[model samples]
Target: MDIQYVDTYELTRAGQEVHGQAPIDQFERLIEDLPEQADTMVSWTVKGEMDSFGQRFLRVHVKAAPMLECQRCMKPFEWPVDSHNRLEVVNSEAALNVDDAADADPDDAIIERILGSQRLDVLALVEDEIILSLPYVPKHDVCTLLSEPLEEEPDGDLARPSPFAVLGQLKKD
Candidate 1:
């Protein structure tokens, strides 16, 4: 299915929500980070909300399980992704400066800011969030490769001498 775009201002004012499931392959940037493009479906929901102060914002939620290569084992494994973010729609680019905005208003410190857009791409936003949620180095708690026993050599030599054995001999010298 094609990704949808929405008018940030109108959606927030009307308190509307857009939701859909798109295949993982649809997200180009996300595909580059994955081990392989599997038939994974990413479910996403973008809900517009207005605070009591009349400020417009968007609540983005995404969920998916994509295959990632384990850094430790170099093997492919499924990584669960469930993330939510609140983005305050700002009228100008200056307001997008989180540090400045947070300094001016303490409330802005907690919530992220985004430039208001008439054609806000929901798929891009979802992909960005998923990427941000990913670990810098993806790895399993206990890699199967580590737990499994090493195979014996063709000559039936199962044990290899430790590299540290040379250090032990030097100690005697």
Candidate 2:
């Protein structure tokens, strides 16, 4: 879903209304399709306002379900993702670049881009949040039903060596 600058401006003036589900395919950059899992559904509401810098700012609250694979068991899992993001729309590229350089935190990179753009792409923002929030390695806890049971060693005793241990002693003679 391409968000146009004009649409954002209109939203700021007349209060934008957001609802319904957004297809995971809309965020092709952030995620790829897998054979085992289904697409994600994102639902959100975005409220826009003018910030102190006279830039348009939007606050988005999103809820989604992302399908992922469990790193340990290689099983598929559906995880719930909910997050809130704040975005600022700037009027010029130079100001956006300046804001990015001044912002020290790596987490704020998306915000900087939004601030630089004349248009606010809410779908892109949601995609960024989803990718950032995903775990590097997904695993189920020990208590989970999917967890594998540990194997026990036989006889509960350590094995001993043979009597031929003395054969090395005779070799020197």
Candidate 3:
């Protein structure tokens, strides 16, 4: 869902009293499109403030139950994930772009944008947080049903290169 920037601005101006639920369909779309396996049920609460840095910031706490395929056994398993995120929405395109380019830190960029904006997109902020919270490699616990060992190769030397390794060899000039 496209969160109304106007509402965000109003909330900030009115002492940042915003609180509510955001649609999760957009987040679901992102998970579906991910190259790796992932599924989650997420909910969040957003609190806005003007930080010491003089930027309008939103502090978000998200709770989720993520389902992912085990890397070792390739079976699905569930894991709980709780994340806290801070975001900033900047007003001017110039300022936003400059902040985006100046530093690669997500938190810093977010704070810059929030403090600089009169309005913010709540949905966008939530989506960004969720994306950031996703694990790079999700694995089940050792005792989980999905955990298992793979069979050893018939050859005693399991580290040997495959026949296809010749594909990388350069032809003689």
For each candidate in turn, give its C-alpha RMSD to the true structure in angstroms: 15.0, 19.4, 15.5
Q: How many backbone clashes does candidate 2 have?
A: 1
Candidate 3, after superposition: displacement of residue 128 in Å? 2.4
Residue pairs that clash (backbone atoms under 3 angstroms), model 3? 56-115, 88-110, 88-113, 88-114, 89-113, 89-114, 90-113
Question: How do the candidates rank by TM-score, highest first?
Answer: 1, 2, 3
How many clashes does each candidate structure show, in the order listed? Answer: 0, 1, 7
lDDT of 3 by residue, 1-173 (tens): 22345354555445454444433444665467343433333455666666566555566776544456666666766555457766565566666556354656754544435444455565556666666666677565573455356555487666775423422221110
Whole-model Cα lDDT of every candidate shown, in order:
0.79, 0.59, 0.53
Leading candidate by lDDT = 1
lDDT of 2: 0.59
Predicted candidate 1 versus true structure: per-residue lDDT over 1-173, tens digit per residue: 36489899988999998888777888889878578865667888899999899888999998877788999889887777779899889999887764655355575567778788999988889999999888899998668767666445476443664424422332232
Candidate 3: lDDT over CA atoms?
Answer: 0.53
Structural similarity to truth (TM-score) of each candidate? 0.78, 0.60, 0.57
Compose the digit string of candidate 2's lDDT tens values, residues 1-173. 33423356766555565544566656676567422445445666677677555667667776666666777666676665667777666666666667454655676665633543345566776777777777777664442455457556476433643223322222222
True-structure lDDT of candidate 1:
0.79
Worst 10 residues of 1 by lDDT: 164-173
TM-score of 1: 0.78
Which regions of candidate 3 fall more than 4 Å away from where they truly are?
Answer: 1-6, 22-26, 33-41, 52-54, 99-121, 143-173
